[model samples]
Target: MLLCDVVTTSASVAATRSRLAKVEAIAGLLRRAGDQVGTVVSYLAGAPAQGRIGAGWRTLVGLSVPPAQEPTLTVAAVDTTLGEVAVTSGKGSAARRTTLLEGLFGAATADEQRFLLRLLTGELRQGALEGVMLDAIAAAGDDTVGKQEVRRAFMLSGRLADTATAALTGGAAALAGFGLTLGRPIRPMLASPGESLAEALAMGECVVEYKLDGARIQVHKDGDDVHVYTRTLREITGAVPELVDLVRALDCRTAVLDGETLALDDGGRPRPFQETMSRFGATVERELPLHPYFFDCVHLDGTDLVDAPLRERNAALHRAVGDALVIPGVLAPTGEQAEQVLADALERGHEGVVVKDLDSAYQAGRRGKAWRKIKPVHTLDLVVLAAEWGHGRRTGYLSNLHLGARDPDGGPPVMVGKTFKGLTDELLAWQTTEFPTHETHRDDWAVHLRPRLVVEIALDGVQVSTRYPGGVALRFARVVRYRPDKQPADADTIDAVRALLPGAEAAGRG
Candidate 1:
């Protein structure tokens, strides 16, 4: 199939708001993809099969190539070209890459050029992210392959491209063959924010675990060979050799442990999040010795516990790690008990407690209601939509963040409000350097960015508003911190923000 056909389908998907229409368009493309299913799916999902190629807005802005008068670029040809561009590096590689890109873009049509630009810069905001693409894949798969099976395979493999290829070629049997590989990283299970301890406990009997203010680490261990990954699945095995040592000393031979790691002060109290981050981010040599706290074990002793209940996973974790490394948790706690757990965590300089359903299975990559995190302050994980140039003493820096809440129905983020508060000089400098890399477009006052950066914003409440698309705005919003651990898909939805509004329940019923 031609690359133009895939690009045209993506355009149609973006133009329509109807999920069914988007699915149909994508499903048709997948059926026509034939042998190029993997590359086609990857492109339609707004990513290159070759991944990040070091190309940025700076390289593409000034270098414009004349468009081709005809649509003749094949999907396999584009994929091969991108692969060449990605592998080109070292001395004189920049000039070589630019020449390759110029040739490729010059051969593409105008619409194809726009599509290539978006795909390269990672700004293809068509509202058809991995979740929607997964649905479309299921729709296009053979009748033997169930949607649940496809989802499970995708979660286990951590690559939609691989899943799509398997589903297309080998059907359900190939997809079902995907299992918890010892070295591969599976998506971490996520938690939604709980309104209160009472509200969280009202669900059912819960296991209240301390929510540590540290970097999330998923350790995959097979004897001495250990690999560690961040929440976003970036491997950091070499940065922290201490963590590798700790995992190597574990009782189990092969295990996948999910937990947090942080630097603790001399008094055994958890250090500031920034201090912990500094330790984790260190590359040359590790200064501080970081500690690992194991909470859940997804796999142990060659057995996969992802299908097992939380109770079983917790037991497996205890059996694998020493008591000192185990995260503290209480089973079937009452409302008062849950509150005490939260208080204890806060007193220990921790974030709060995560109340989890005792019988819930670990649903990787799904932020279900089974686990709820209760923090002290009311905070929302919002996407950074844009930023304005600073003034006064803050000149030349990006300040005044424009925040948006995620749409519940997989649409673009609904702009909630803007804030210039809670930013330190360090954060301002970082934003100034970083925001432009993610820039989609810019005007005189502000530079719009791809909705990718997730920021935890502390807010007093939500008020009905006409200024924003969500019909509600954040009141007294201020940045708590930049959540490098989260993605825009993990941001709090508009309905979650609406739940904070006064009389929200009554309004919903009405």
Candidate 2:
């Protein structure tokens, strides 16, 4: 198929507000994409099949090319050319990459050029994400495949491209054949925030575990081979050699453990989140050693525990890691007991406690209500929409941040409030250097960004407001830390922010 056809379908998908219409358009395109299923799926979801290729906005915006009078570029041809551009490296590679991009863009039509520019710069604003694309993939199966089956296959495989290909070529039965492997990583389960400890216990018997303020990791061990992956499934085995050695010391031959990893101080307490992240993102040096605490085991001793209940999984975790590394927890605690658990966690310099349903199975990649997190203070993950220039002693820096919450209906983020608090000198210097790289437009006072950076913010509460489109604003907001582990899609929704309103509980239950 021609690149213009895919570009035209993407335009139609972005123009319509109805999700059903978007799904229908994508399903029709998927039916037509015979051998280019991988490329088509990746482009429709606003990403490249080749992944990040060291290309940035600074490199692409400098080239100018004339448009072709006719559409002659094929999808496979573009994919191959991008693969070439990605692999080009070393001396004099920059000039060669620019020449290659110029030739490709010059051959594309005007609309095709727009699509390519957006796709390369990671600014494709189409409303279709992986969730909507999964629905479209099922729709293209002509009722031979179910939506839930496709979702499960996607969660296990950790790749939408592979799941779509399986459903398209081998039907539903082939898609159902996907299972947990020892070395491969599956999507990790997530949690939702509860209003209070009493409310969390109201759900019935539960297991409350301390929520550590650290990076989420999934460790897989098979005999002498060990691999570690982040929550987003990026392998960091080489950077974290200490963790590799630690997992190899376990008793089980093959296992998959889900938990948190952090660096500790001399007093055996957790360090600041920024200090831990500094070590997490480093690749060359080994300055800080990280420690792991196992909470749940998904696979152990050649058996998959994903289908088992939480009680069974915890037992497996204890047998695998023993009492020294197991997270502290209590079973079926009362309201007062749960409060005491939270207090103990805070006293030990931990985040909070996660109340989990005792009989609930591990729902990978889905943020269901089976698990709820309770923290001492309320915090929200919000996007940076814009930043204003600093004043006085902070002159010549990007100081104040305009924050927005994600829209639940797949729309753009809604503005909530702004904050300049909780920023250190290092953070201020880093923002001044990094904010302009994501700049979409600029003015005299502030420079607007692409809403890509996610930051965790601590707030007092929420109040009714007519200034913002969400009808709510944050009270006494301040920054806690920047979340490089999370994406913009992972930000809290506008409705989640409004749930902190004074009378929101009564309105919610009614």
Identify the candidate with maximal TM-score.
2
Model 2 agreement with the true structure over 425-504: per-residue lDDT tens digits: 99999999999988999999998999899999999999999999999999999999999888888899898999999999
**Candidate 2 structure, TM-score to reference:** 0.96
TM-score of each: 0.95, 0.96
- For the record, the alpha-carbon RMSD of candidate 1 to the native fold, in angstroms, is 1.9
lDDT of 1 by residue, 252-314 (tens): 899999999988999878876777777656778877888888889999999999999998988
Task: State each model's C-alpha RMSD to the native.
Answer: 1.9, 1.6
Candidate 2, which segments miss by more than 4 Å at Cα?
none
Candidate 1's C-alpha runs over 4 A off are 391-396, 408-410, 505-510
Clashing pairs in 1: none
